[model samples]
Target chain A: MENIILTSSPTTPYFPEVSFDIDKGICEIRGESYMEETYKFYLPLINWIKDYIKLIKKPLVLDIKLIYLNTSSTKCVLDILEILKDYEDDSGQVKVNWYYDKSDPDMIDEVEDFEAESGIKIELKEF
Target chain B: MTSKTILSYKGPFYIELISVFGTNIRNFNDTYSNARKKLFKIFIELSQNVSNYSENFHMVNNVQRIGVGELFLKELDTAYCFTTINQVKRTDAEILAERCEIVNASDQMKLRELKREQRLNSPGEKFGARIGLIQAVMLSKNQLEYKVENINENFSYFSLTVKIDKY
Candidate 1:
C-alpha cells in the first residue's frame, strides 16, 4: 500500500497539520480546524484510513494535537474515530493517543467527550 | 453631508461595537482562549447560514446577502458574556428560534451524547443546523439566550447572547 501524506495550510478555514506515516502506520492530526467546508477536507483522510485498514493491516497509531476545532470539524473528527473504532472491533491493532497542552483543560474535556461518544479508549497525554 | 444623519443609522453596528469591547478581560487567560475560539466558530457558522439560506441573495458574494451582524464580548465581574447580532428573514428566524429552544432545553450531558450520535450517523457534508449551536454551547460550557425583533414584514433582527463563567 502506498503512503498518504497531506500538509495542512493555515490559509484555509480548517487549518490542520497532518503527517501520516504509512510505513510505521502512525498518523497525526494537529492544529486548529474551523473550515467553511469541513467534511470535504476530511473525506480524503477518512478514505485513506479505510483503505489502510484493508491493505496494510498494521498497528495504527493516531496522534491528535488539535488545540481548537469548530463544531463542524469536531463532527468530522468523530467520523474518523468511528472508522478507527471499526478497525479495532475487527481485531486490527490500533491505539489513539490525544496530546494536549497541560494548561488547556478545554482540550482535555474534548478528548474525554470523544472517548465517551465513540466508545473507543483514547490515551490522553498532557504535554 | 450633515454629521447627524450620517451616524443616525448606527443600529446593529453599535451592538457589534459593544460585543467587541466586552472581549477585553483582565484575568482568566484560559477562559479567554476558550471564548475566543468559540466566538470565531460561531461567526463562521452564523455567517454561512446567512450566505447559504438567506432568500434575498443567491450569489455567494453579493454584498446585500451578507448578514449585518456583530459579536461583542463583555467581561463581567465574575463571568464573560458574548453576544452576536444579525438580521434574518422571518422564516429563518422561526427555524432559528425552534433550534434554540431545543438546544436550551437539553442538559449538557444529553447534548454531548447527542452530538456524538449525530456525528456517527450524520452524513459528513450535510451537518444539521441546530447541532452546531448545541455543540458550541456544550463546548463553551455556557448558556445561550436569544431575542427576535420584527423589522419589516419579511425580516427580523436576531440577537444571541452566551455567557461563560470564569473559574
Candidate 2:
C-alpha cells in the first residue's frame, strides 16, 4: 500500500496532518481538527486504515498529537480507533500513543475517553 | 411615526454594534495562532447554540444559521472575558441554568473527568445539544456564568460569559 500524507489547514477545514508509512507501519495524526465537513474529511482516512489492516499485517503504531479537536472530529477519531481495535482483535499487533501537553488537563481526559470508548489501550505521553 | 421610520432610527444602532464587534475581532492579536483557533471554535459553538436551540428567531439558509445576539470579547489585565447574550425558551433557559450551575460549581479537575465520561457516552451524530456548554467551559479553562432575563413569562434571554486566561 502507498503512504498517505496530508498537511493540516485552518482556512478550509479540520483535516489533520497525516502520515501513514506502509513500510514502517507508522501512522501519525497531528494538529488541530475542527472541520465543518467532518465526515467528508475523515472517510478516506478510515478507508485507508481498513485497507492497511487487510493488506499489511505488520505491527502498527498510531500516534495522535492533536491539540484541539471539535466534537464532530472526536467522533471521526473514535471511528479510526474502532478500526484499530478491530485489527488488534484479529491478532494484528497495534499500539496507539496519544501525546498531549502536560499543562492541558482537558486533552488528557479526551484521550482517556477515546481509550475507554474504543476499548483500546492508548499510551498517554506527556509533552 | 411609521414602522419604516422606527426601523430607520434603529438601523444606525445595529450598524454601530456590528462595527464595534468587527473592530474587537480585528484588534484581537495578542497570541493569534493558537488562541485565535480556540476563540473561533468557542465562538462557533456558542453562537450556534443561539441559532439551533434558542427560542429566538434565527435565520436559516441552506445548512447555515444566523442568530441575533451580542458577543463581546474584552481583554483585562490578566485574562479575556467572552460574553454572549441571546433569547431562549423557558425550558431551554432552565436547562441552561442547571448546566451552568453544575459547571460553575465544579472544579477544573472534576469538570475534566465529567467531560471525559460525557464524551464516551455521547452518540456520534447529535452535536450542539449536550456537549457544547461543557466544551465551551473546558476550552476556556474557566468557569461559566449564566443569567436569565424574563421576557414575558414563557421565554427568557440567557446570557453566558466565559473567561480565558492569557498565558
Candidate 3:
C-alpha cells in the first residue's frame, strides 16, 4: 500500500491539521475545525480511511487532538470513527486515541459520548 | 432588554463572514478569554446553522447562491445574549420549533442524553439535526428560545436566541 502524507495549512482559517500516514498506520487530526463546508473537506478523509481499511490489512491508529471543533466537524469525526469501528468489528486491528486538555471537562465528556455512541473504545490522553 | 449591543449583523451568512465576526468579537472581548471562547463557539455553531440551512438565498456574480440571515449579540449585566434570524421552509420551522421545545424542556442530563441519541441516530447525510443545537444550549447554559413568524405559506422567518451566563 502506498503512503499518503498531507501537510496541514491555514488556507481556510481554523481548519484542522490533517496528516494521514498509511505506511505507519497513523492518522492524526489536530487544531481547530469550524468550517461550514464540512462535507467537502471531510469526505475525502473519510474515503481515504475507508479505502485504507479495505486494502491495507494493517493495524490502524487514529489520533484526534482538536482544540475545538464545531458541531458539523464533530459529526465528521464520528463518521471517521464509525469507519474504524466497523473495521475493528470485522476483526481488523484498530486503535483510537483522543487527546484533550485536562482543564476542559467538556472535551472529556464529548469523547466519552463518542465512545458510548459508537461502541468503540477510545483511549483518552489528557494534558 | 437593557443590555447594550456588542455586535449586530444583518445580511448574507456567507462562510467568510463567520471569520469576520469571530475576529471582531475576539478584538472586543479579549479580556474574558473563557467566556469569549464559549461565545465564539456558540456563535459559530448557531450562525453556521443559518448559513447552511437558511431558505433565503441570493446570487453572487449571477453564479453562486448564498444564505442570508441576521445575527446579534448583546451584553447584559450578568450574561450575553446571542440571536440569529433567518428564513426557513415552513416545515423546517415546525421541526425546529418542536426540537427547541424538547431541548428547552429537558434538564442538562436529559439534554446530554438527547444529544447522544441524536448523534448516534443521525444518518450519514451531510446535513440534518446534529450537535449544533445541543452544543449551543450546553455552552449557553440556558434554554433555547425560538420563534417562527409567517412569511407566506411555504416559508417562515425563524429566530433563535441563546444566552451565555458570565462566570
* DockQ-sorted candidate list, best first: 3, 1, 2
Interface RMSD of each: 5.3, 6.4, 2.1
lDDT (10s digit) by residue, model 2, range A8-38: 5534334479898888889998986655445
| CA lDDT, candidate 2, residue B64 | 43
Tell me, what's the RMSD of every candidate? 6.4, 7.6, 2.3
lDDT of 3 by residue, B1-167 (tens): 47899889988887778877875675574566667777888888888888777888877899667789999999888888899999999998999998898888888888889888887777745674387888888777899988999999999999999988777
List model 1 lDDT by residue over A42-62, tens digit each: 888888899899988889999
Q: In terms of docking quality, how is candidate 2 classified? A: incorrect
**TM-score-best of 1 and 3:** 3
DockQ: the better of candidates 2 and 3: 3
List the candidate 2 regions with Cα displacement exceeding 4 Å. A1-10, A19-26, A54-58, A99-106, A116-119, A124-127, B1-61, B66-68, B126-129, B139-141, B150-155
Residues B1-167, candidate 2, lDDT per residue (tens digit)? 11111001111112224323333453456564445445555665565455445555534355544446656666665565677788788887998899888987877777767776676666654351247778777777777888899998788889987766655
Candidate 1 — which residues are off by over 4 angstroms?
Answer: A8-13, B1-68, B128-130
**Which ten-residue region of model 2 chain B has the weakest summed lDDT?**
B2-11
Q: Interface Cα RMSD for candidate 2?
A: 6.4
Q: In candidate 3, what are the lDDT values of residues A32-124, reduced to their tens digit?
A: 888756777888889889989888879999999997888777788888888899999999999999999875667887898788877899999
Better of 1 and 3 by lDDT: 3
Candidate 3 lands at a TM-score of 0.90
DockQ of each: 0.33, 0.20, 0.53
